[model samples]
Structure formats: C-alpha cells, structure tokens
Target: MAASMSVTFLDVGQGDATLVSADGHHVLIDGGQARDDAIVPLRRKGIQQLDLVVATHAHADHIGGLISVLEDKPVDTLWYNGDEHTTQTFEAFLDAALDSAARYVEPTRGRTKALGGLEVTALHPGGDTQGGHLHDRNIVVRVSQGACSAVITGDIETDGEHDILRSSIEVDADVLELGHHGSRTSTGQRWLEAVDPDYVVAQYSEGNHYGHPHGEVLERVERAGAEMLGTGAHGTIRMRCSGGEWQARTEAQGPVVAGDREAEAAPGAPAEEPPATEAEVGCIDLNEASPEALEQIVHIGSVRAEAIIDGRPWSSVSELDVIHGLGPARVGDIEEQGEACVR
Candidate 1:
C-alpha cells in the first residue's frame, strides 16, 4: 500500500493549487489562477474528485482555476473567506460555487470535518474587523491525519496575522503555507515563532512580476529553520499519510522505505552517498523518523533535529534551514532527507 496520505502541490507558475488525498479521500485547496492550465496538472496527477474546495480569498491567483477544477471533478464542499472587495475573480469563484451545487462554507475559527480518517479544521478567517482594516483577511484551513498536519494560509498578511494570533485558535501547525507567496509583510517573526512549522510552502509563478518570495521573507523563513518547497522548483508536491508515517511523492522525487535509513549507516558515510530509495533528495516526512533519523543527512545536526520535531509537516523544504549547517547546498544533498515526517 502507499506509505501515507498525500498532498500534491501543483507547479502552476504564480498560482496556488494543492491536491490532497488521505485515508481514501480527496480534497483540493485551490486551483491555479489560470483555471485551464490548472486542470491539466490536476489530470496529470490523477485527481478525480474534490471533497473540499477552499478559496482562501478573492484573489485571482487563488481561485482563477476553480472553473477548470470543478469541470474535471465535482467539488463536494466549497469554502472561501467572504471578501469585502468585488474583484472579477471573486465573482467568478462565487459563480462556480453556485453553479456546481457545492455547499459554500464560510469557515470560522474552529470548524472541523472528516475526510476519510483525515481531520480538516479551519484556523483563520476571524472576519473583517470593525473600523478600517487591511483586507488580507483569508480562510486558512488546517488538514491533519494522525500526527501529520498542514496549515494552508491564503493570501494573508501581517495585519491578518495579528487577528489570527489573537483568536482562541491553535496556530501551532506542522507545516505553514507561507502567506502572500512569502511576502516580507506577511510572515511576521512573532507569527513565525508561533507556528514554527517544519516546512514553509510557497506558491508563485516563475519569472512573474513583483518578485515573490522576497529576499527578506526568504531570509526570515530560513532563519526560522523551516524548509521551503516551491511550485516553481518542486514541480508538483504530493504526500501520502500511512498512519504516522507520511510518505511524500513528487514529480521531482522518488520512493523510500523506512528501514533503508538505518542499519545501513556507514558511520562516516559520505554525505554524497547514494540514496537508498529513488525518493527525491532533501524531502522528509515529519511524522516518521527520529533525531538520529534526521542526522542521516550531511549537515543536519541536533539543533536542526529539534526544529524538525518541533515543527511537524513543513510547508516546504526551503524553510527547513539546511543551509544553517550545509550552506547553499545542492538539492541532491537534502532533497529527500525527510524534511518533516508528519503523519
């Protein structure tokens, strides 16, 4: 059987779309901004049904591909943070939600649902505050299966971050979908401290204007010791949850067996030693493995181990801070090292 539940993050240049399957259920977080382009990737990844469709906000990059996603697969439950602005893309999302006969869910601070055995909970969308407020309000969804969990934060910014921090919500997550494509204004240090995810995933188009994942944001993400995964680089990120051992699959990676990590240790095994499985390098599941399991990589040490265990499923590998020990290391070195073994 597959090792675990799966989260497939499509590389749709500058757009956001993640296909997730866990415990025999499928849930799509969002489609790329280009609905047509997004559907092709969905088909490529073998996505057929969308048990839940979440439009984090009314941004084009977040929901432009909704029509295409629904066209390919029926969306069972549609959720979006109600917007105060009336952008064309927002209207399109509402239309698709209505036409598809989906149950529109305005997620609150603590609503939960069961997708197979996986648990999905809402953590953001405290609603637009009274008086003047920055409009980055978003519907952040947290999906968990056993010990693994990932928090998907839609185009939220620092102001929105404040609201989420103030709420009586569980901000602690294994992985955090970096807000606003890793904008400097979104990942506040305090907020980062609260989540301290093992991975930080970013959704952005290649060569797009407004240079997403700004340098400062990138530095902050790295400083936090979380890893970064990108649609720009990782191709498509897919994960599987097998009880507590979350196995990940991606267009850029291969396969792995648990025992392969241990018993084969050559003590001083060269950091450049070959991987036991065809699994992608630098990528690890937070739900599985141990401190020693973490040290298998070249530069990884005790501190990095703490970060991995401290944070569960990471949004991406870039935020994992491998550079802390390895330094601008090549992808092959840490690519499949089990970023966060979250189940």
Candidate 2:
C-alpha cells in the first residue's frame, strides 16, 4: 500500500500551522505569522505543491503567514469562511487570494474534496445559521487516509462543538487538533463526550504571554484519557495514522505511546448535533496561570475560550487560568483592569 498522510503541528508560537501529507499531496490548515517562515517547515515535509488550503477564519495569527505561502508558491483550492469581516488583516487576506487564480470555496457543511489519499469534508457551518459568531462559525474538517482519520476544528468554540454534537454527522477520529488553543471555552464537557479523540494537541507559543492549556482544560483532556501533545511545550507534534496504528513525535514528561488508543468499539460521536453555549469561562479567572502563562495570551484565538469553563470548581483562588480565555496577557490586562491577584 502507499504511504499514509501525516499531520504536523508547526511550532508557530501562539499561532497555528498544520500540514497534512497523504499520497505525496499537501493540505495546509491555518498558516503561522506573516513572515513566511512556515514554508521551511513545509519544505521539510517534502511538499512540492499545496493541493488544498483551509483557512479556519480571518484571524491574523492564522492567516498572516498565508500571504507568504501564496506569494512564495502555488496552491490549488482555498477553503475559508468568506464573510467580509473587513479588518485590515481580513482584507489583506482577501486581496492575497484574489491575487492568485486559485478557487475560494466557502466553508459549509458537506463540502467535500479528495486529493490522492486525503479525503476531506466540511462538517460544520451549516446553512440557516447566524454568521457573526465567527469563532463558533469556524469550519470543521474530516480527513482520512486508509484506516486512519483526523478531524481539524478551526477555532471552533463551545457553541460550535456542541452544535456539531447535536447534529446527525460523525465525529469519529484518531487525532483531534483542539480548537482555540485549549482555552476552556471550546472544549465543553458534551463536546469531549462527543469527540473522544485518542490523541489531542494545542498549538501555542512557548512562554506565551497567555497561560495556555488552561489547567482545568488540560485536566479535561486528561480526564478523557486522551494523549495530549502541545506545541508550546512539546515542540512540533507529528502524527501518522495508518493501518489502524498511530505514531507521534512527542515531548511528554512521562511515557509515550506510538499507536492509536483502542477505543474502536465506541460509537462514532455524533457530528450533526445542535449548538450549545457556555455557562462560565476561564479568561474570566486570573489566579490559575503560572509565570510562563503571561505571554501566550496576546494573540489567543477565540475558539478555545468558548469551552474554557466546564462545570468544575476552582480548587482555590490560585487557579486563575481556569476561567475562560484570559491567559497571560489577559491576566496582566485584567490586573491593569484592577483585578490582579496577589500571585
């Protein structure tokens, strides 16, 4: 059989840059900052041409480097939410796409494309929905090669995850790129009960101004018994799903597994589900983060903030990062707002 697709979580600091390679084809999901630095990583992956590009949303951290990619190389199809967000950043992104003759496909439910071993479908952003909730309106992609499959959630927040769960679609997968930097807002309890990913990751910057991988959010991921690999601490997380076995490059403090977790018999989580909102959030809390937490939050995306708050108790006033969204910079900003705790 031919080779399987591999997913690489590029170390773009607090931003996101993922490359999916299958059967010698390339698919990029959210590039890094505007410096065009992600190209080196793509070259390392042996990417000759980009067959597909998925822009989760118009956030600069995700779309900035895309300018570089387009300027430097040729890409076939670009999948993105086409709403006129109108920010200078968003406009620049639009201008870049128009500069190229590549097709711009609006992200919608059931939009499917196949390139060699990679088969990807848009499973979220259904019609008859409000478009303003951009984070929740983020696209969710289902990709598979041979016996292994992965789902990429683009900045999808609690509302989006819960909505997908209530739908009649399927959320089964070997690996899941956590939405929104693991901000407690995106991965709500029901969302976890639904995805149940075997391997998970959060793409954030090291010593980021924001304390990412919220303590409670990390606990939630651990509670699901998923193997979590983060870019901030683990470097670039790489995973290959083939022949029902999964292998990943990790920097875990403990032992690591090189294959997929056997949750095979479990029902594929519901995908075409309805949306739900959050009860509380982590950014609202300030005491939980460590000193390393302060820098990462400056460019924290909105996806994870949606689920940052679960129905859990703050062990003490110290776990400030448990609240939704406020990572390092926000906490500092919050203190500037006269809420800095005696940490």
Candidate 3:
C-alpha cells in the first residue's frame, strides 16, 4: 500500500480527541470525555493497537477518555506533559498509564522523533508550567510527512502561543488545530499569520456553555484566508494526505476540497435534510423546538430535553449521537416517533 497519513478530529462533545495515523502506525492525541468517544472511532478504523499516545495535559476534557483507552488497548509509548494535577480523572489516568504496557515519557521542547513514517517535533512546554494554569502548560506537537504537516495545539491560550512563537519553533503547517477550542484567548493574529494554514479544525461541542471558535477568532481565520471546520457543526473531520496533496471529508457534510475556503457546505449544496411537514412539525423541530416540546418524546426527560434544546440547528437528527448516552437505537426511535424533529 502507498504510504498514507490521516487525522480524525473526533466529535467527542466539548472535548478533544484526535487520531493521527501515518502508513498504518497510529498515535492518539487526546482522548475525549467518554470511552466510546475514543474507542468506538478507533475500532471503526480497525486500530487495535496504538504506537503512541499523548495526553497534552491533565484536564478532564483532554485526558478523561484516555483512561479507558489505556485499559482497553495496547499502546507502545505514552507521552504526557509532567505537570502535577490532583483531579480524580488525572489521578486515574496516571494509574492507568503506570499499569499499561506502554513506556512513559514526559516530552519537553526541542525533541524530535519518528512515528511510523511521520516526523513529530515537540514545540511547546519548553520548561516548567506557565502561570500555574494547566491550559498554559499544554504540550504542542507538530506531525509531518513529506510536504504535508499539522500542528496540534492542546488547549493552549494566548500566552502559550507567544511562548511557542518566542522559542522560534516552526509553527507553519498545512493543517492547524485551533488552540483552546478556538477560544478568543488563542489563535491570535500573529499566530495565524505565521501558520498560514490551508485548513483549521476547531475541536469543540455544539451548544457548549463556553462559546468556542469565538467570533473574533473566526474573523481572524477568515482574514488569514484559511478554510475553517468545526467539530460542532461538521461532525468528525477527516483529512487524508498522500504525496504533497490532501483532501478533507466530514461525517455529515461529505468531501471538502482542501483549498476551499468556504466555512460551510457549498452554496448550491443541500443546506439540510427536508424539514418535517406541517403534520410532522406539530411534534417539534429539533432546531426550533423548546425544551418543553422536546420532553414529549418517548425517552426524553427534562435534562435530555434541555440538552437537545441546547444542541441546536441540527443539520440532521443523526447528530443526536453526539449527546452522551444517546445511541443509534434511541435516535432511530426519536426519528420514527417524529416527536423530536430536525431541519
């Protein structure tokens, strides 16, 4: 088989989990909040063993699901920033890491290694933690194969961005994983200018309480003339690169031309699945439905109903799978009942 590399920005609901594979060797960046959020996607890709695994930081949203991955899969090497954290999730991750078969390494800046056929360079956490904040202590890494490269920024804020810039690390890449879930605090003008990415992926949940990929950051990315894709609206974004060229595909939106700057589906592309009819509309349109209206569904309670309301503007009702604990059977039932509608 020709050497191929791909990255999957998993939609783990307000968390970050990316699977990077090059020529069949795999390295899991950050496992999201739930076990299936990480494992299901891995199993689907037919990845039973991980060559390397990285926990950028100790935050639950970043490393929570990694515990399950460590317990379930065979990982050869586990890399993490050596920042001390006391949260139960962090402690559990540590225990799992210690017990797993993987060799543990706390990588620092200026280190370079080969993962399968890809080259990886550590570009952040040059030294001790900054400002005593976990977000500031994030580990940044760049993965490259031939002319294609990607930078994975692990929830680092503006200060961390500056730190990377000051170190003169090569931040330029074809794909830039937006820092801090596209929070205004990251992806500053200078950083975007330096990267000049062809595409950017913001890993975040739709309708999350914390507004991510903030308006200002979006404007900055547009100004940089790079295509932006969010896990929130786009679902899982997959990029496959061979030679010097790459193409992106989404779970729902279909294939995305790598150089296309459009943030959403093409202008003439179908905007959404056909809307529920007036009779069906009597039940509820998920995008427009109120919490009270959603509660009328068979298994939907006040909490789930509110969650459904919060996760709005569904391009398809299938997005309900992003909601924790809502499986395909439940989603199918909801769709059949026609009680919870979608645009």
lDDT of each: 0.64, 0.66, 0.78
Question: 244 in model 3: Cα distance from truth in Å?
Answer: 1.9
Off by over 4 Å in 2: 251-343
Q: lDDT, candidate 1, residue 204?
A: 71
Best by lDDT: 3
Any idea what lDDT model 3 has? 0.78
- Candidate 3 residue runs with Cα over 4 Å from true position: 261-343
- Give one digit per residue, the lDDT tens place, for model 1 in 205-311: 65557777777887787788665666554455555444455444434434323334321221112223333332343245544555544543334555776667686
What would the per-residue lDDT of candidate 2 be over residues 259-286, giving only the tens digit for each residue? 4443111111221222221101112232
lDDT of 3 by residue, 6-71 (tens): 777898988999988764467899999876779876654446789889899999999999999999
Q: Which ten residues in a row have the lowest lDDT in candidate 1?
A: 262-271
Evaluate residue 97 in candidate 3 and report its C-alpha lDDT on the 0 to 100 scale.
94
Q: What residue pairs are clashing in model 3?
A: 286-341
Worst 10 residues of 3 by lDDT: 274-283
TM-score sort, best first: 3, 2, 1
Query: Model 1, clash count?
Result: 53
